[model samples]
Target: EWAKAFNPFFAGENADWLAMIPFGILALILYYVGRELLLSGKKTRA
Candidate 1:
C-alpha cells in the first residue's frame, strides 16, 4: 500500500523508467567526479 505509493514500479503494470531517472543522473555525476579526481591525482604524482 504505502510502499506502492512510494515506488511506482511495484504498483504499475508497465516498467517505471521515470523512477530510474534520478539514479542515472546520479551515476553520471559520480562517474565524472571520479574521473576528475583520478586525473588530478595522476597530475599531482607526476
Candidate 2:
C-alpha cells in the first residue's frame, strides 16, 4: 500500500520504534506552541 511505501521503516530491514518517541514528543510540543502563538496573535488583533 501507499502507506507502507512512505513509512520510514518500510525501506529498511530494521524498525526503530524507540527512535520515534522523541520525534513524537517534539511534534506535540511544536503543535501546542504554534497553536498558542496563533491564538495570542488573534487576541491582540481583535
Candidate 3:
C-alpha cells in the first residue's frame, strides 16, 4: 500500500505506451521505403 503512494512515475504508463507509437510507425515506413528502393535497383528479367 505504501509502495503505490511512494511511486509517482507510474502515472505515465499510458503516455509511455503512446510515445512509442510514432517511432514504431516511422520505423515500419522506413523499412518499407528501403526495401522498395533495394528491389527497384536490380535490373533483370530472368
Q: Please, what are the lDDT tens digits per residue for candidate 3 over residues 1-46? A: 6534564434444666766788999888889778785345767788
Candidate 1, number of clashes: 0
Per-model TM-score versus the true fold: 0.48, 0.46, 0.49
CA-lDDT, candidates in order: 0.72, 0.68, 0.67
lDDT of 1 by residue, 1-46 (tens): 8967776766765547767888999898889888795344545544
Better of 2 and 3 by TM-score: 3
Using TM-score as the measure, which candidate wins? 3
Best by lDDT: 1
Model 3's TM-score against the true structure: 0.49
Off-target runs (Cα >4 Å) in candidate 2 are 1-15, 37-46
In candidate 1, the residue pairs with backbone N, CA or C atoms under 3 Å apart (3 or more residues apart, or in different chains) clash, namely none
**What's the CA RMSD for each of the models?**
4.4, 6.3, 6.4
Summing lDDT over every window of 10 consecutive residues in candidate 1, give the lowest-scoring window.
37-46
Clash totals in order: 0, 0, 0
